[model samples]
Target: MGLKPWQKALFPLRSVAAVVRLFEAELRQPEPDLVLLSLVLGFVEHFLAVNRVLPTNVPGLTFESRPGPDPQTRLYFPVAELSIVAALYARFTAQIRGAVDLSLYPRPDGCSSRELVRKVSDVIWNSLSRSYFKDRAHIQSLFSFITGEEGPPRVPPGTKLDSSGVAFAVVGACQVLGLPDVHLALSEDHAWVAFGAGGSQTAEVTWHGKGNEDRRGQPVQAGVAERSWLYLKGSYLRCTRHMEVAFMVCAINPSIDGHTDSLELLQLQQRLLWLLYDMGHLDRYPMALGNLADLEELEPTPGRPDPLTLYHQGIHSARTYYNNEHIYPYLYLAGFHCRNKNVKEALEAWADTATVIQE
Candidate 1:
């Protein structure tokens, strides 16, 4: 059968446009219909299948092919899979919306948008896993659809962290910590923070922890052993080990030696480290304080009025500066101490940080 020239050209264009418009419209609404969203995604899948754009073995629930009396074709999703998608979508959207609404309520700790997205993804994954015991790939596709990811969920090579989640979390942490000017630099397997013109100042704050077992079946311990090292201006500062303390020293180094450039460097480093910790990279604390102890061992930079005196002065100045920040670091330090079995110090730190928070 021969088709009209205009019909062939316009049909595919209209089909693609419809799918795009459906998603665009759905996203603009505060509360979109989950069933409608699922239908739109299904429509896209079907369109791809009809046009032979998608490979035959693509992961996800397959639409049963039905031959019609006429030349026209259509796609049909399994009733069971569609039901699961709708249910999962409803649960995810409700929880996400609730978390966002609750963030408005007064509290010392606030939730970030990245956290909200994670919460939603977790809930959806859990719900789907519980309901659909098989077809992991199909479940992932459905998840990707609801989360607006291009394809199935994947952990990037050479990293355990979800790049999308980390990127979003870093941005959210910056906004929360009042460092709006800080920018994120992302690569295929890593992401970090950068500040200043041309990103002259940079910090790698992403977590790089080893999981339970390596390829050799060796037990991989977490914490400092699994901590990823950070670089500053192509120089290995070992800042990842004692991220917070490193930032403090850097921030106050200028006060010690009267160097404007070092002060700016430290300030940017401090902000980046704070965002990293707040974004749930908690295991770096072991290395963080350890790095602080090694600070005195560093060689004195040129033009310092008094090398020994300036080093001590910088340490003291950094401590005082951090102390004035309303006990934020103390709370984290308390957790670090507790994790390291310093119960007495943890208790004291917690008590002090709590008092500040209460006031």
Candidate 2:
């Protein structure tokens, strides 16, 4: 039977309680510092992607992936965020050209590179997070000195260069900014953000290797294409696929037990499920929401007065997916989820609906 009005009202409240308890349980988990760091980095990466500090074509750099409860595991983001961040960074690096010495820190350790890259990314992210970058001139100044004269002709495909496609995207970004291209090498196995092109002081990205450049066989103007893709395709490839993997891994992996409570993960899943529902994805099958609730049931309940209230809270507290507006996936999932129910039969009767959407 459908829930009475009173029961429905209680539902959202119960969800909220579940969320709070889950959050508290998560807080109580060991090594809270690591979890906080992951959240910070995740937020930083999300901001960078949202603001275009990185490139979109590079593999293993997307913000779509959620950090797992396991602190030891690192998640990779996709190219869309990377492309945007790289473009913004390229612009900033262009401005800081002469002022900052790239040579002093050439080929630094992975941690150093991550630190340096994170710093610049953070600057752009923080600026946007604070909503303070009021003018283009300030942005231009940030990138002016970093861009230099033209560098080596575009790196040939077959030949390995110390620069990744993301680096060149930055180079191409310099071109976009009218800054001369700069060339420099970063250590292999990693993408580098360094200074020195052909013109005056310039910065370059150099780190060529498998999974670093665009292996998808995108065109030479690929950098331009990548920028366009990031600007247009909010759920670029990595966010779509890689993110799923990260979540799936987090959900299924049982080996890394103590650091993150499984029940909290289930609670998180419930929250995600409701978010999907609120977005109209689960309108056809309320049971899918029930599926998530069942999962969250595995976790021990907190001191909250009602379990349902906690669940709704968790749903409200979960982060929104990268782009929640576009509805293709929602429609697809709705169709799939309702296949055996009344919704499915109705959809089948209105087969033309699917065709119309495709057209």
Candidate 3:
């Protein structure tokens, strides 16, 4: 059944218009509009038929928004860079279709719109899933569900530690676990994770590292004389393969409970060492050495030996950081191993290390 002339004439252009309209609608939202547009545009370029122009109302071209970690990180394309890419793809793709029609499909242009879109989207998606927005949304959801009950109202940006500050709750857990070797590594540019076994694996818990920050000049804070944006440009955030190996090991260990029993502690520590090695950190002596050093530095609090032994200890410690989700893994480590006698001192130091999140 040969198609009617009018039907063929309208299909391709209508499809192009529909995709463009979708981009326009997405850009109006407060969230990462550009990131969403990039994904959608890429899809259109790679898969949409080019023979007929379709309107912007086509349902197939629309992508449903998938729930992800709050404020998820994807490829950090500058607004201008993204605008250019999306606009070019949209325009050129339609042009290709028009050209193909003129040539009677016997020989379409060498560069198909669909093929180019596929290539670009694939690269963007891979970089995004690994480098940013891995499992942040789920962590946020879990946190809200656990702690949103009646309390001294929780504020946004709770505790402010640049990237490496440990959540206060974890420090309290340290007191409970009696493991002096656990401590948070503070940095302004990146979030990092490092532990000596016995932590939670409900999601991807990885440490962030400090990549050098480029100078923007001057401290914007009122009291401080120095000011600069704590931004790292062209910095690639990555976890060594060992982190994954560690993640898997921690997931199966039975010693990761909150009881802090001696038998469990021994097993957890043994399992942790194996994970650290799997993460390729066996030769990276300093990180492990640092953990031990942190353990030794905890000042013994007279009364609060098992800081986490008390239920309130968790609340008090968590008070130090606004959003406590980032450090849940560390809390699991400290809570599972630390004993009551010396955990308080470590908890105090961890508290002092964190900066309260500012509005």
Quote the positional error of residue 107 for candidate 3 in Å. 25
Candidate 3 residue runs with Cα over 4 Å from true position: 1-237, 255-338, 356-359
Better of 2 and 3 by TM-score: 2
lDDT of 2 by residue, 184-279 (tens): 122112222333222112122332243333222122233324533222222221111112212221222121233533332344445544444444
lDDT of 3: 0.28
**lDDT tens per residue, model 3, 74-151:** 211111123433443344333333323323212132322222222222222222222232222112111111112233
Measured on C-alpha atoms, candidate 1 has an lDDT of 0.34
Between candidates 1 and 3, the TM-score winner: 1
Q: Write the per-residue lDDT of candidate 1 for residues 54-77, one digit (tens) a residue.
A: 346544545444453357955332
- Best-fitting candidate, measured by lDDT? 1
Which ranges of candidate 1 are over 4 A from the true structure? 1-15, 24-88, 97-186, 190-359
Instruction: State the displacement of the C-alpha of residue 42, model 1, in Å, after optimal TM-score superposition.
Output: 8.0
TM-scores, one per candidate = 0.25, 0.24, 0.21
Best by TM-score: 1
